[model samples]
Target: MSPRFLCTLIIVLGFVSCGLPAKRREDKTKCPHVKAIRNFDLHELLGSWFVVQYFASSEEALSYGCMRPVFSMSSDRLEVSMNFTYTFTDDPAAELLYGNITWEIPNPSRPSHWVHAEDTYEGVYNTYVLDSDYKSWALLLHCAEKSKSPRYLSSFIMSRQPILAPNVVTYLREKLPRYDIDLAYMFPMTQTNCSNTNRESGLDRDTVRYVIKQSESNRRHPMKRLHKP
Candidate 1:
């Protein structure tokens, strides 16, 4: 079989065999900080999503270039993972970065609204799907408390395909106000060169070690406040 066809088959199989959600407390807020899509299907959200445009602040813009968000249902919660390469300077060689986070439908009644707890980081992400068609595009908000003192906010526009349609971009731009998201900080990602990179099955070794090391060290440091910095 052709490589393209094989790749397509793998994604198709992934969607078909996506795991079921575990029992969790349902979130029942009619109007969360960000509006979530009504009657969203968690099952339909399995597989890989390409981020077309994203908005982030200076504190969070550590990496860039070709980010593909992958989702799968774990034994209890929805597992999210991604691996990308970024360069600190204009160098040809880039270093790989792995991200891992888990989510739960805090309120099953509101399927589009979810909560994120990172395995490798120090923040709890409140995620809301503003819109999705289960096929083409998805607009998500990532809100988290950096610490007891400061908060962080960002938004992501993901698509089944790498390119976001002009109309879709316009639509999301106009809708940003309702969620209190600023378009001025938005950054458009580059996806063309990522097609050649090999996708890792899960988080790499360095990421795993970092998490373990942090968790151990955090024992001494009071966990009273999970600082975002």
Candidate 2:
């Protein structure tokens, strides 16, 4: 099969098998052209962050709980990797899913902007740090597009703590509408009753690197799913 068709098939299979949320259609309007924050410090942004609120134009509602991502920057500061663990909100067992996402800083001058470096991802995926304070809270925007296709957008409001102050949440939430994010669906993620389950799936630095390495070695075909559960 051709690469494009294989990509489509992989995406469809991912949504079906991973308990991933089925994608909802976006508003017909084009994706908003947004800007990354100026002088975004990669060092300051490194570390664990709890996702306080998540907004994906492609999702009608929230699907994950206890969404946490730990960011690590390479010593050279050219590559950034995210090791995250999350459970589906509807899941009774609350089974955690571990995933890795890596990106490269195409331009060190624009450290806030990154391009997905994983071959598994089939599109032109770009991540932007719209705003952040590096201590208490942060606002992030991610956009992806492929030839002639409508861009896909998703955002995260992250806090160093499980819960962010309401006023601060509101402050960050206000920044997304300009990018055409719907306020009503910006769902709060549940951080209660969550913990690292086993040693193998632990999100520590060593474990994350091992898991990612294993995944990289197993990728033998273009049809492998791009989006992790």
Candidate that scores best on TM-score: 2
Give per-residue CA lDDT, model 2, range 1-229, as digits (tens). 8866776787777644334366765553344566656777889999999998987765677777888899999999999999888876644444567778899999998899888998777677888888889999989887776555566678889999999999999999999988877899888989987874535333566665555465554322211222332
Question: At residue 63, what lDDT does model 1 achieve?
Answer: 39
True-structure Cα RMSD, model 1: 20.1
RMSD for each model, in Å, please? 20.1, 14.6
The lowest-lDDT stretch of 10 consecutive residues in candidate 2 is 219-228
lDDT of 1 at 184: 70
Which numbered prediction scores highest in lDDT against the true structure?
2
The C-alpha TM-scores of every prediction are 0.63, 0.72
Compared with the true structure, what per-residue lDDT tens digits does model 1 show for residues 142-193?
6665444345566778889989898988897777766555677676877765
Evaluate model 1: give its TM-score.
Answer: 0.63
lDDT for predicted candidate 1 compared with the true structure? 0.59
